[model samples]
Target chain A: MLEIKNLHVKLEDEDKVILRGVNLSIGPGEVHAIMGPNGSGKSTLSYVLAGRDGYAVTEGSATLEGEELLEMEPEARAAAGLFLAFQYPVEIPGVGNMTFLRTAVNAQKKSRGEPELSAAEFLKLVREKAKTLKIDADMLKRPVNVGFSGGEKKRNEILQMAMLEPRMCILDETDSGLDVDAMKLVADGVNALRDAGRSFLVITHYQRLLDHIKPDVVHIMAAGQIIRTGGPELALEVEANGYADILAEVN
Target chain B: MALAKLKDDALAARLAGLPASAASGWLAAAQTEARARLAAMGLPLRRDEYWRYTDPATLNAPEVPSAARFEAGDEAPAFDGIDRLKIVFVDGVFDPAASDDLALAGVEIERLALAGQADIHWAQGTYGVLEARGQTPVARPFAALGSALATEGVLIRVTGQATRPIALNYHHVSDTSDAILHHCVKLEAGANLTLLESGPGAARLTKVLEVDVGEGASFHHIRVQGRDHERRAATHVFAQVQAGARFKSFTLTANGRLTRNEAVIDLVGPNASAHLAGAAVGDGDFHHDDTVFVTHAAPECESRQVFKKVLMNGATGVFQGKILVKPGAQKTDGYQISQSLLLDEDSQFLAKPELEIYADDVKCSHGSTSGAIDETALFYLQSRGVPRAAAQGLLVLAFLAETIQEIADEAIAEDIRSRLEGWLQRHAAKGAT
Candidate 1:
């Protein structure tokens, strides 16, 4: 469902290289987890795939179902069924969370030539989806992520994911600021959305999250390249032995 | 030589062309004093310290190019939903055909011209008196000019709680119509009243409103400037608060070629509170200014001034606000904040905030800021599929919501919000992708 061939990315205004010669492939219904250390270009891969600005893609191409992902604006990418759950969800002070969600949903639907949902229909659907994520009505009515706790923000991201229902999802460090219980709640939410027609690329530094989401394939990325590929057992091995053995093994 | 003291050619010519008013006895004496004051002060020139940020050329023009009459029937006039004592004025002339009976319990209302024509009237003591008193610390010659040439006005006095708001609805039907309206309001001790003003009176309009709040009384004033794109107006309000009194005023301005609103407030008694707020949005060829001065003369008083503006294209906004805490006024509290959102590269915001404190035991703070939209928040919204223009509209409304909440009444706040939303919808960019 997604392909990245020789994707070389760099900071737009500087010579600093972020993603160098990165290559990855994920089939439909497959969940791929990338394990890496700090500054290992894991987040860069997700950002480039989602068509974020401020990056110079000097070398290669990334595609989703044979469509050039880099050629679309961020909103166009979202309309084309690519979703990125930010590591740090921004706090928007004025826009209500419910209003923001509805606008986003309606905008995407309009772009795809679909009938827009009525206010009542949108509210009912959002409430049902939010129930699974433990988000109450108060959270939905308040400004988006203004004063939310770390765990609440992550859960809100998952709520958005469920509502949007994108075919390809990229979760960038979703487990970073979450506790064990919170992590399980988020992982369970992700697992429920897994189906034959959808796929996920989960970028994380720890093995605890995979313990819950259970990826179909695992890759070890260092510097700017994915150097190792295995199954769920690979994640367990890193959890037990740490990245030292893996880095040396890959080199 | 005294009459020749008016050096500015434009102001002198405008004053020379005033229509006759049947001012006799004390009313005539007051008008003569105001005329002398205007002559001495001349008109506010662009080089004047207070007028540096906003050029007064349009306000000083003898005859500004008349604006095309606007037709606004999409919805009922702003406060039509609420039951009120509606007094209508068409092109500065009181239209009895369109007005309700000028009768209400707990208040006395009279037209200014009728009072002047009468041999004896209560306006003898208070008309233009408060405005003359507001000339110190800084000179407001336009207010003085409004007092001198205004032949049409309303005089209102309240002794108890008013059951309905006093609404002034202005209708514009002439291109070259110039209106000068002065309103004098006085609330007796333990009284309560609300005054509402709306519509564009004329292409070039000058207005003054003076209010006095007695002990233990409350006064509220809410104004919505009209949406005529080529209209120009200058309005000044002078207010006084006695002990244990409350005064609150808010204004919403949109789509005027030139508009200036000035307010001068005095807190003369302990425990009195006053709050003044405004929100303005202008797009292309619009110049909006808010100049406010607040003084705390009595101990243990509180005052607040909040203003916010959204400017797009080549529109400009100006704010000059000051708060002064006099000596021996202990435990005084004052707050002032002015902010503007510049939607494009060409829009500009000019602000000047000043605070003077003579008492040591006082808490006063002031802040002014001008910034573009939050790019991070913009991207966050855009990333979730909100189009660029829609996201901008959301942010613009969010920025003004804080200032709008300062209104003490929710119903009025909601009315202003809907008006602002309508403007944003109409001005949304074309070819938005």
Candidate 2:
């Protein structure tokens, strides 16, 4: 389970507050949807939770399984079962995706005091995962995100999330650049990895992705705070009427 | 005091009478020039600007006399799997018994001393001079010394229209207790050849190679400097490229106590091209320096120089690269990048990339970066279950893969990579325990 309590964060350089007293909690076997328009601090919440540098946490605490997540390093947080599906994946030249993924997975395992996987075993597992995700094996062999199409990059990210098998994953705009078909495939991949003891926080600008994953709770974020919280029908209301009516009521 | 002075005087006299050679007219002249230069400049002291990073005093000792001949022992060492034409040099002397008469259809491989005077004259006329105008001050001592004592080397002539890649392997093994001066190699026009030079077991060996590529010719030169630990070696390669010719040089300096691989490439003709790439791994108390000088003399020419150095423990590494675009050389594309990674705090690197362009139309840039390994990447790998050493090794390999991947020969590149990985593993194990 992950918990964010009245989190207020600001940029380190300019002291401009981005996330203002936003509170959220998600337990295992639950999916939370945070829908917001541009400049709504949705991505900021993801970065703050993932322990990215340059974000100053002013007066809030983020805990994963009762462990202090905000104080941990980004990679340490990742090893601690926290995953962020980046809105735009980084392009690392001269590093193969398979090599990077293997390193990441093995690093997490080592941190957990687990036995490492051999090259053969890792290859077999990754190839099987690739087939289920509709990802070409050759794409995994190429440099990470280099020369890949936008959709392929997004798919590769999901494939990484699946490979890491984090306990709590924050999907930040995983459905933004994907086409209708790619969106369905990526949603299906995420759903396949879903289980009772795992949770997901799907952040999106559209309600289309939610139609597939079907979140248990829907929250509308405005300016720098979450203004409204409702069940799944809230997504339908926002989709049909838009956030303008909600923004008016919240302001 | 007088008795002690007498002993010192006797030692100096013995050193002076040490049977040094003045053979080969050009070599004699070069030695004379070097002695004069040494008298004026003296042995580069710590105060010299060019030698500031690497002190020559630590390596300087009374010069030993060059050996006259390499004595042949029982059987030569076996190099069974390597298919190239093996040219063996024992104690700095060329061995015909070990060398196959490379009677390829269009290529010519011969000892430089045995080559006809006309051919030697042609080579000297083509590539002998160092184009002294822009030569570095640090090179003065070595150039003078090499020019003075280099008597024999290899001359490889690939005739125009030849296709087979000529492999020239220089195997140096010391038989007697003497220092060796082996100067070898010359490539001719339109001839495409791949030259692999290695110093297997050399003790105090110095080999100088002078290469000349004719118009429209191509040369692939790979130098593997893996001498014995006690050996103090230096290999200098001077290449002169003509119009429409191409020259690519790759150097791997993995093992040596004190090794310096210096290359001077001159783009003499219009539209000529040259690629100089090298990777050096120095651990222990070893010291390695890779210095390159690429000159653009003609218009519309291209030259690229990439050098990578990895050092551990108290080992030291140096990469000094210079790109010079002359006044009339317009539209020249010259790029130089030198990077170094120090694995320990005591390890040191001095990488300086200099660019001097006199032509406004030229695009010349040089960058030098030196840093420790990326800790974030290290932690990233470590958190993924890779042990600390394995993670560091993988990161170092990824860092060096940029340079190694540029090698055109798959086998050679893989060989170099495996050797580097092995070295890293050994160093990591040492650190672990």
Candidate 3:
């Protein structure tokens, strides 16, 4: 469902490269977890696929469902069913969370030549989805991410992913600031959305989150590229003995 | 010396043939007195200290270019369906034929024209009294000019709580009309009133509003400068807040070639409070300025000034606000904030914020900022599938939301908000192309 070959990316404002010659592939219905230490180009790979600016794909090709992802704008990418649950969800002061989600849902639908959900219809759908994630209706009424606790923000991100129902989803460090309870809740939300047609690329620094939402495959990333790829046992190995042995083996 | 010479030259070229006649009585004498002061002080020049940022040439012309009369679309006019006393003015002349009678509960209202040609009345003293009082620290030549030539207005006196708001609705009919309007409001102790003003009065409009708020009185003013894209107007409000009085005013301006709104407020009694706020949206060739001066003369007074402007595509905005606390006015609270959202690289904002304090134990703060939209916020919205221009429009409305909240009346606030939203929607469409 997703493919990247020889992807090399450098900061647009600087010459230093962040992602160099990374190759990855995920099939439909597969949950792939990318475990890496800090600054290991795991998040960079996700950002490059989601079409964020400030990075130049110097040499690489990325496609999703046979459509090139490198040439689309961020919104177009989202409309093309690409979702990125940011590590630090932005706090937009003036826009209410409900308004933001509704606009986003309608926009994606319109881009895909579908009818928009009426206000009443949208409200009902959001309430049902929010109940599962344990998000109070009050959170949706307030401005987007403003004054929300870390757990609430993560839960909100999961709610957005469920509502968008993207074909390919990337969760960038969704477990960084979450407690164990919050992690389990987030994992449950993600597990419920998993299907034969939807795939997820979860990026994390530890295997704590993988316990709840088991991954089909695990990749250990060091420096700028994926150095090793194996079955779910790879995550357990990385968790048991940090990334040192893997780095030595790759070198 | 240079200012004097420049002022003199500007006066000759700008005020050569404007009518300054009034009824033959003390009112006329007051007009003559103000006219004499205007001649001496002259008009402000681009080189003047206060006029440094905004050029006065367009407003100082002998003849103001006529703006195409605005025809409001199917949208219900502002304050529609609200209980109000509608007072109409066409081309700066009172149109009683289309106005409600001056009958209202707890209030006495009279047209300035009724104090006919040969009599001295109560309005004679208040005609230019406050305008002259404000000339002490700053020379507001335009305000003095408004007092000198103004002939079309009303005098309203509130002795108790007014049941309905008074609406001053101006309608423009003449293309080259030059209008000067002066309104005087006196509220007795413990009285309450709300004033609503809207519409494009003329091609070139100058207005002065003087309010005498007695002890424990409450007054509110909300005005929407009409959508005449080529209109040139300068309006001034002079207010005196007595002990424990409350005065709050908010203005929402959508479009105009040039508009200057000046307000001078004096907190004369202990515990008095005053808030002055405005929100303006301007497109290409638009220029809007708000100059406010507030004084704390008695102990424990509080004052706030909040001004926000959104300019796009070569539009310009200017703000010059000052807060002064007198000696022995301890425990005074003064706050001032002026901000501008420049949608593009070419738009501009100029601000001068000042605080002059003589009291040692007072809290005063002021800040000004001019910037483009928050790029991160814009991206966050756009990344959610909202179009780029729509995202920009949302940010602009959010930027102005703070000022809109200053309105004390919820219904009026909602009306102003929708008006701004409508403006943003239309402008966003224009920008998209």
Scored by TM-score, the top model is: 3
Please give the distance, in angstroms, between residue A152's alpha carbon in candidate 3 and its true position after superposition.
2.5
Worst 10 residues of 3 chain B by lDDT: B114-123
Query: B63, model 2: CA deviation in Å?
Result: 7.1
Q: Sort by DockQ, best first.
A: 1, 3, 2
Model 3 C-alpha lDDT per residue in residues A46-162, reported as the tens digit of each score: 888877768999998988888888998778888888888988888887778998899899989998999999999999999999999999989999989999999999999999999
TM-score of 1: 0.93
Please name the candidate that would achieve the greatest DockQ relative to the true structure: 1
For A1-251, candidate 1 gives per-residue lDDT tens digits of 88989989998989999888988899999999999888989988887777677889989888888889888878888888888999999898888999989999999999999999999999999999999989999999999998999999999999998988899999999999999999999998999999998999999998999989989999999888887899999999988998899899877
B4-60: candidate 1 lDDT, tens digit per residue: 344466567776666745477656777788888887788887767888988887777
User: What are the per-residue Cα lDDT tens digits for candidate 2 across A2-120?
Assistant: 99899999999987999999989999979999998999999989878876657899898999999989888677788889888878776655678898888888878877888988999
TM-score of each: 0.93, 0.72, 0.94
- Write candidate 3's Cα lDDT for B1-433 as tens digits: 8878888887887777676475566667878888898998998988777788777787777887878888778977888867899999997999999899998899999887665254767666577888899987898988888888778899998999999999999888888888889889999999999999998789888899999999999999999998889888889999999999999999998898889999999999999999999999999989999999999999999999999999988999999999999999999999999999998888999999999999999999999999888877777776667777777777787788788888978888888988888888898888531
Per-residue error for B381 in candidate 2, Å, reads: 4.6
Clashes of each: 0, 13, 0
> Candidate 2: lDDT of B183?
45
